[model samples]
Target: MWAQAKSGPLPHPITAAGTAPVHDPVPGELYFWPTTDVLAVYYADLGQAVPDPGLIRLGAIDTGLDDLAHAGRRVTVRIDIEGVQ
Candidate 1:
């Protein structure tokens, strides 16, 4: 999407929406594929190293460092917590 938007390249279903199609960012598009799907969505990098899509496709991960920028960084996460009965 980012590449296409920047390059004017397009996908199979180009439409009035332009090269980049629109969709809600959360569960709508996030889970559009199985974790193993051969697709990705990218965003701005906050001074981080450029990520290798191959590494991401293979589930390679980064080790978080206790840096000044991340000193108080924390996230509360929940997943699949409902309808388990």
Candidate 2:
């Protein structure tokens, strides 16, 4: 599914457990669950409906949170630590 989504709509591999229940998924936050291989973002404002639960946190959205509007929307990710450089 991910392979096909490389260019088109990519759907998150929802597992039985789902992502950790984020009561307040802050905008610009990204999460990935290894068990399900699902990637999600908090495109909406904080304290919105929970995306998924039981996901192994992937990372935070540094930029482009506005672009993430839907659930199955695809996105590019980049990781960097503050004060590391």
Per-model TM-score versus the true fold: 0.17, 0.41
Q: List model 1 lDDT by residue over 1-85, tens digit each.
A: 3321111111232122222222322211111122223233222233333222221211111222123123332423222323458
Span of 10 residues, lowest total lDDT, candidate 1: 2-11
lDDT of each: 0.24, 0.47
| Candidate maximizing lDDT | 2
Candidate 2: RMSD over Cα atoms?
8.0
Model 1: residues with Cα > 4 Å off, grouped in runs: 1-22, 27-32, 35-78
- Give the per-residue lDDT of model 2 (tens digit) for 1-84: 221111222264644354445434455666554445655555556334444443344457676554445424445644565765
lDDT of 1 at 57: 19
Model 2: colliding residue pairs:
18-53, 18-54, 19-52, 19-53, 19-54, 19-55, 20-54, 20-55, 32-58
The alpha-carbon root-mean-square deviation between model 1 and the true structure, to one decimal in Å, is: 13.8
